[model samples]
Target: MDSDELREVLQEAGLSPYQSKAYVALLELGTASARELVEASDVPDPRIYDVVRSLEDRGYVETYEQDTMRARAHSPADVLDDLQNRASRFEQAADEIEDRWEQPELDRHAASIVKRFETVVDRARLFIQEAENQIQLSASIEQYEQLRGVLADALDRGVYIQLSIYTNPDDDVELPAEEQLAATTTEARHRPIPSPFVALIDRQKACFGPHEDALNEYGVLVDDRMHEYIFHWYYSSCLWEICDEIYSSRNDEPPIEYVDVREFIRDVEPMLLDDLSVGVRVVGKDVSTGEERELEGEVADVFYEGDDYRGTREIPLAQLAGRASVTVATDEGEFTVGGEGAMLEDVEAMRLTITSASE
Candidate 1:
């Protein structure tokens, strides 16, 4: 490499300017005294000893004592190995510290943003490794193009694979490079889902995103075990079961038309409402009095009188900020009640829980 590039690399390797120059000089000259080193390199005389000592401590240099002290630079391979080892140690320590301090929040937001294909690809890679028994993938031609390699890798390792593709009928379907790798080693199959999102990876991970036209607008990976479990319940037990029946009967028709009220609500509201408890606020003028009254608490029930118009009744709690309130529990004392509007706002910001302090 050129001097400029080498210097930049040294900087990345955690070397100071003078240290890099001094080390490079030693490398060229083999062995040199402090005076010779100072004259040959850009390092000043006063800082030479400190720089030499730093290099020696880092195992990049060896110092010899005689009438005059001399130092020799270590081989590039040895120096590079030492630097890499030190870096690995630092990274392991940092990961431990972060695990203790930031893991809870880190896992929550790791796949929230879908800025680039790389982020989704990485999440898919992680999911493949985490998958113990099964993987279900549904994606557009474009998404599958990016994820083919990850799927193939998982299949090679003996993980069960089931993939569904959503593409135009005229579009040519081909496995991604990675998927091709696993195709020979694992069970691989594909079908079509009308929707563009992909959701299958054992019961541990799920990647949901937009169709081709809206690709840049939405994408998310759910890695949390609790979230994945809930999704599996709905997808496997409810959605996929009916989808299987439809496929077997060659009924390529929309299944919602056949679903009962309970299934209809589940299909319409993709949001898992079982583990979810909602808060509601009613703001209206009392019919008996001319005064305005607001009632807010955990939503006991939500009923719709007509399309686009919904009514909710919540147990009254102490009033808080505008139309919001705090529910006082018998044992837990008091906790703020956040309504559906607030929940929607939170979701847009990539937040999952209203109880988050940062929100």
Candidate 2:
């Protein structure tokens, strides 16, 4: 590759422009002083030292105490290997932190509508991979038809697929001739959704769509890590404790119910007191504070009012008290929600208070 292409590749590999150029220059020149690097690489004289120091720290360059101070670049293969290793470590750390912190935020709005088909497909794909024991789907006629491919793929991969469709007077539940002849196939049992409908994948992920004209509108998919963790435990518990409630009866009941908690809360808000009850949990920390204080009792009670509703809620210290920022668990994944003035009382109320009075 030419210099520009090489520079771009280095940048994509996580090297700064100056560092890439200086390293490349060192590579070409073998061993060189900062002054030689600046001349060879066209890096400004003032910034060469900083770039060299950064490159040295990043393992792309090494410093030597010769007659005069000198720096030498590591081989290209060695540098690229170092960069790849660093990238892998960073990604692993991010994934771990996200799983620990971001899942709770997603659960708070688990029933929110999903409008984008692409998002639905992406979430559904994730749900399929996460499913372990069972998949129960209650889909609109159009959505059910559209997802035939996905369902067939899952079945082919050995996933148990159970499907239910809205009973249409004019349509049949069995696969059409063309669909049956297609490359995809599903070992699925079919039924009708009693009310609207819901899709549950191993109870780890759930989706809800409207009863009327659901295919025309959007829906939501809930596969948040925290919710998944909770559901996994719920699914694995002793049958004596909650078996009947947790396990569905294939003979009579719909495999999954479409329960929109937000709608339920909205319809029940009038009965609840003006004060809203909110609970916040600290899930993970991001910033390094040498203090070893436990996050327990870091939450505070606050009140707020709005034209629609007024309520009281507790905001976690991670949200209210700003010392070091931390990640919290949410239904979606790990995210930075609170900390450094992020927890506004009014905002929290607006978020949690369901206005049943308005319908």
- Indicate which candidate wins on TM-score: 1
lDDT of 2 by residue, 1-359 (tens): 45565565677778888887887677666567788889999999999999988987775666655456677553233454444455564344333322322232222323434443333544565566555545656555566666767776775675545554444545555534434523332223333433244556754476654555455655555655344334333322311112122122222221211122122233233333444332333322222432222222211222222322333232222232122222323454444322212332111110121211210
Worst 10 residues of 1 by lDDT: 344-353
Candidates in order, TM-scores: namely: 0.34, 0.29
Candidate 1 achieves a global lDDT of: 0.47
**lDDT of candidate 1 over 250-303, digit per residue (tens):** 122222121111222222222223434433233322333424434433423222
Model 2: how far residue 258 lies from native, Å: 23
RMSD of each: 18.4, 19.3
Going through the candidates in the order shown, the clash numbers are: 5, 22
Reference-based TM-score, model 2: 0.29
Q: CA shift at 32, candidate 1, in angstroms?
A: 46
User: What lDDT is obtained when candidate 2 is compared to the true structure?
Assistant: 0.45
Best by lDDT: 1
